[model samples]
Target: MTRGLTPSVHAIWQAMGLVPPPGPLGARHDFTIEDTDLILRLAPDGQAATLEGTLGALTPDPHEATAQLRKLLRLGLGLAGFNRAALVLPDVNGADAAGAAALMALADRRPDQPPLRVTAQARIAPGDPRAAVAALEDILQWRSFARDVIPASAEPATAAAHPASPATPPDSGADFVIFQP
Candidate 1:
């Protein structure tokens, strides 16, 4: 049996100095990438990732959303991109790493730039389909400049919607965990 692996990417990336943004301990957190305004959320288990935004320069045509999703997300990054891009570090490899760095640099030089804006047609409006998108994004706050993402330590939620959910590893304490997804 392996003796040095755990299920928490947070623990590993933190050890490697690739920190994510500050978030609640034990509670899954979200990130708003300052460079592109991409909102990323990791699954409760930290194995699956979801990226949401107004669509970037490459995703301008709504018809290309799915293709862009595949292309942009084609990075072999897994949690690496999550830690670096979200935390504003360089990914070891892949387009996202470059994008992450670009965003980080942009954040530094144009610190005042507003969150990357979605196209005009994509704007959320009353009775608009995109309204759902707006609702989802409204929950994210630029607490830390998207590039200011840092290492996260889990804090068990006092109350959870899923009471039987698996507990978050106590800091770096999940020695016996393995993620199948």
Candidate 2:
């Protein structure tokens, strides 16, 4: 099992007022996403959130595990009114880059709300889930910075420039792998 790299995720879930019922030590975080009941068991650098339904959907593609993690977290936060949230992905030698980009593209789908943000930052250890989770702080900062930098009523210039793009960059960092706009 990976280290408890997803403690931040757990905290985020708690912030949204959704938490799993108490259980034995390391109680799994119970929640639903995309109509899927997930039981999140913390690992060393990540959490193992197994799909808890029919055998047809028991496990996600191993290669897409990171993607699945991102999706579940984003969906929950979005429902909790953190729709404009940013995802800070670690540049793990391109390990999770594609997944992060996919998330960014997905983030722009909700034109009604602000675009999703994704940044590939440095100083955070690569191949460590904590790196990605740690970046959450920067993401929250970006949200606040975005509010002040961009006019609340107006969409970002990039979003305006491309009205049909699903990937929008609400904010970006120099080392970040920006997506959408």
Best by TM-score: 2
Count of backbone clashes, every candidate in sequence: 6, 10
- Estimate the TM-score for candidate 2: 0.24
- Score residue 106 of candidate 2 by CA lDDT: 47
Q: Could you tell me which residue pairs clash in candidate 2?
A: 1-44, 2-43, 2-44, 2-45, 3-43, 3-44, 3-45, 120-176, 167-180, 168-181
Writing each residue's lDDT as its tens digit, candidate 1 over 115-168 gives: 222211111222232332333333232212221221112221121245564677
List candidate 1 segments past 4 Å from native: 1-28, 32-34, 42-47, 57-181
**Model 2 stretches astray by more than 4 angstroms:** 20-137, 147-181
Question: What is the lDDT of every predicted structure here?
Answer: 0.32, 0.36
What lDDT tens digits, residue by residue, belong to model 2 across residues 1-181? 3334244344445555678234333434444433222333443344432212100110122223334445544543553453323334334356666544444444443223223323312223423444433334344443333332322232222432435644545564335466896
Query: Lowest summed-lDDT stretch of 10 residues in model 2?
Result: 51-60
For each of the candidates, the C-alpha root-mean-square deviation to the true structure, in angstroms, is: 23.6, 18.1
